[model samples]
Target: MEMSNMPLGGHWVLVIIMIILATWVIYRYLAPQNAKEWRNAGLIQGFIIALYAEMYGFPLTIYLLTGFFGLEIPWLHMRGHLWSTLLGLGDVGAMIEMIIGLGLVILGLLLLARGWSQVYKAQKENRLVTDGLYTYVRHPQYTGIFLILFGQLVHWPTILTLLLFPVIVVAYIYLARQEESAMRKAFGQKYVEYMKRTRMFFPEIKNWKLLFKKG
Candidate 1:
């Protein structure tokens, strides 16, 4: 593949814009309330920056693959869709992956937003939030984060992001456990009952329809 005609780098502006936009949406919807939440948020911030930095600002993964592994990937921006490229699916596969990835991102954002709204209102009333998304998952906002990050992974896979993904998941899982401990203290047996009924992250199959319905 000829590399001279297809440029691969110098897209820092797009990189900056994407990072800022993604971080803003994340902070806005899933606003961190304390030190722990903020720490987890920082991990996500780093993930976004590293993901976009490689995606637009540089093609480190492509370079590493071509130079170190001796692969012959073209240096086109579209070639950044590594999964499709590796799978030999070409442009059409990239488009399909992008559409699916974007769909997951949108769904994650909706879940984050709705979860935030409900939790905020419940906090004001000093009540437990076990309705709406909370009816399904004990930690819907975290699930949203999972979805968004997974979506980004599908859209554009990078070494750094791949490494950070599981770390972020583990961090959120720990955070969720800490949160549950507090909720258990605050709500006593009521929260215990809720926990018994609702799964921590994944929703039950029978209650799937309730996810689409308004709370």
Candidate 2:
């Protein structure tokens, strides 16, 4: 297909449907019942909204930087699917990106489900959760978000969304630190012990590996 002949509007429609599905999933299944501090909720909500807007709505970043993309790419056109443009691939190549993107989507949902289950169970009983995915990462839900964004980056990679990637990482780091302080205060020595045993984002493979070592 000729560069100018490719249809892009359909891609936007797909993005819109995906965003709605994401919002519904979070609100219906993952939203916390315990009263979340307004500030923390607000920050998280803002991040989600920003991500959805660019992912589905106007796509400002893609539109604004059309020239650079157009000039740099020879066979591709800005009027094509945004994913293809950002990933620097053709239609067939974008099929691969879509497959990868879908895998990330499933991974994100699974992580979110696991994290939410742990958090909810703990919150209901008024206790700390340090098991399952929590045993693997202190903030699996945040990790889930990061993975979802990573997938979207692979899927779309618009300038605005791409720029927001590092911002999301830094924001999550700060939020995680603040959350840890609160968790530590709530759980005290137990949390301290858990912290000693667990690495925040990366796993402590040496210690984990020892569990499987033969005597």
| Poorly placed runs, candidate 2 (over 4 Å) | 1-6, 10-17, 28-62, 72-89, 204-215
**Per-residue lDDT over 150-194 for candidate 1, one digit per residue giving the tens place of the 0 to 100 score:** 999999888899999999999999999999999999999999999
Cα lDDT, model 1, residue 201: 84
Model 2 lDDT on a 0 to 1 scale = 0.64
lDDT of each: 0.88, 0.64
lDDT of 1: 0.88
Clashing pairs in 1: none
Q: Kindly report which residue stretches of model 1 are placed more than 4 angstroms away from their true locations once superposed.
A: 1-6
Pick by TM-score: which candidate is best? 1
Report how far off residue 67 is in candidate 2 (Å): 3.3
